[model samples]
Target: MLKGLAGLKAAAAKPNSFARHGVATVLVTAATMALGLLTGILVARSIGPEGRGALTSVLTTVQMLGWLFAMGCGKAVTYTLSRDHSAGGRLLSTWTLILLPLAGLAIGTGYLLLPLLLAAQPPETLELARLYLPMIAMALLSELMLGLILGDQDFRSFNALNFLQPAGVAVVYVALWAAGRFTVEAAVIVQAAMSTLVLAAATALLIRRHGLARPDPALGRKSLWYALRTHGDVVGGVITQRLDLLIIPAVLSAKQVGLYALATSLSWLIVSLSSALATVVMPAATRRGRSGRELVLNSLQATFAIGGLLGGGLFVFADIAISLVYGPSFADSALPLRLLLPGAVLYAAAAILLNGLYAENRPFTATLANLLGMAVTLGGLILFLNSGGILAAAIVSTVAYTLVFAAAATLYRHATGLPWRVFLPDPALLAALPRRLLTKPSPVAAAPANPAGK
Candidate 1:
């Protein structure tokens, strides 16, 4: 009986195209959410609101700068490696060769511009931002390695490493707080150090699993060109998504930024399903010649069930959750948290649609859609944020996401001719999810028949 139970667990863990990969990603995403919440709460309690605000600002700035400099190598690496896994080593090497110099330039430029960009911040906060400078290279390299891992389809390692940085930060923060040394500078340093360690681990894993290949100049140029064309989509999407955070420091108090950050983080617990979907869908979609119709449809149905249930739960518990996780000082976060639910759900659907377009080789379509969303989001913030503050930002976010979803979904449907009804949840697929969870990978999916070689 014990032997049989072991076999059953193994079978259950083995996933194929639809339910299996989705389940694994969902589980990982759930863990990431939990860790993020735990860390957020700890940070909030340790430093209080204003410090939390400064920390959020620095972290957000680090990510934005990293992406700006990384030059879209994340997606480029993924696309290139996905197309031909045999070239995985060379692709990884090429991206590393390109990313190092770019990282330096990006960091140097950010340093020069820091005084202007963060002029509103306190001197201490600015100091913390400077301390986080090393993250520029670390964050960029992390992105490149993440793309390689995704392309290699090493979901286990991917999931493990994804959770490590946050978990590490949280643990370190708690220790520092206990030691009475949990200042903003210490926290920032801890975050950067933890992130760098995680990136190093991932790099070691990639090299161990797929030994490095000599960098190919031609392939490197091609990847760089592709990344350049499509990088805007990623940059725009992230900017729109995190635009509110960037804006809050300028227009609102650090305390308010802290509150808004808490609310969005809670709401993101639901919206982040889109990320999980994108992670699994991108490589799979890249493999199939078609728009990955079956995968997208099934994933959409799953997203609806998963995202809807999670979003509804978040909506209902927004107040209690905010209080429990962030303390009563952040209770004001509930209203914005409630307002962000619709956008979160909408964004989840749009993420899948955007990835579908990428899989279909219509990257420009995805880029344009994100640009539209960014414009709407930024314009709304500029025009209404002065009077309306976080609530207005929330409303604008929902509207912006709605427009983005419509644009991307229309393009996907028009290009693929897959009917609107196909995206709707299928009772059969929902029912099959449980069965799929308990079964081994299908022979077809295991063989990776898709031409992309994933």
Candidate 2:
């Protein structure tokens, strides 16, 4: 089994096509979501809202700190590695050296600032947060490794790692529940423990494939500059997804944060699906021609149709689902989940379009687009508190995501000189998807589009 798995990963080392990889990944992502949801329900049921809220706050803080100091290196490494697959060793070494100290710095900084970051919480929450501060490193390593794997276009290995971590988490949660030893602290410990093991396994794979070599000064400089260029969009995109959790504490109660956290967690089920569709897209987009265009177009269509259906099902059945799985305590989460559905699907589509900007070396335009969305969110938050007290923050968030999708689609077309109609799903392609998914890999050649034609 071990040898066969290794062979699979070897065969998956940068495939020339995205079709099978995308479909398989979407399935894997859906399973991960299931395991994740199970773990969440277990934890939420055991801890209740306030305890769950405290846990959520701490976890969010740790995750935010990790991304805060990441400086977009994860995505940057992906772009750099895709351009020079031979640099695996140097890239691995260089990024390892850079992110370790940055992670350490993030841990130190976050430790000092946890008081401020989680100020909305109680003393017990703050103390528990400080205990798990090292999760900052775990989060950073997670991002770096996943980005590298995806950059290699080895979605099979990528899917393996993705599947393992959540599976471990679910197993751990199940074990704890059976043992009657579940608590927020227990949840935190099990998550970090599983993460540590997963990261170790991933690092071992990287080392075996491309043994750690000295960091190349020239490559290091180039990678750093590239990371900086993409940093704004990277950071803005993360903050946009997470800012609501952090900010909700200030305006609402801790319980509301918990409710909103549950809402967002469920909402990501759709976003991750969107994301899985676009998983290989950025790398694929850089390959000039008809194949790249078709790849993007198909991804857009699949994401829209699949994401819309999932989002809609959850939207309509949210109240029952929340109550059925998480009980009446979390039934209130249904409304927020419903409010976030449209935006969630749109945000996923925006993510797909933004790949064009990155591929075109127009990272700043991508950054500007995300920044616009973030600006709307922040501005709306302020307005929501003052004048729209009667409104839910989820409504504002949905509007912000809608604007981001609009901006991203417009920017992607303008940057790539592609027709706007291409941004929409083609009915023919949608109809052909089932047959295509069943067909063998036939990588289409990239024939350049007519320079004079729209």
List model 1 lDDT by residue over 132-206, tens digit each.
877899988899899899888676788889888878887887888788888778878888788889999999999
Global lDDT of each model? 0.77, 0.77
Candidates in order: C-alpha RMSD to true structure: 6.2, 5.9
Pairs clashing within candidate 2: none
Error at 238, model 1, angstroms: 1.6
Q: Write the per-residue lDDT of candidate 2 for residues 1-454, one digit (tens) a residue.
A: 5764463343334333456677788899989998989988897888888878888888888888888888887777777777678888888888878889998899899888887777778888889889999888878887788777767767788889989989998998899999999888888888788889888887888888778899898998987887887888877776677777766655566777788888888988899976687777776555333335556656777889888889989998998899999989988888888888899999998888777566566677788778888888777877774444314678878888888889988876665566555556667667776345313222222223323211
**Estimated TM-score for each candidate:** 0.90, 0.90
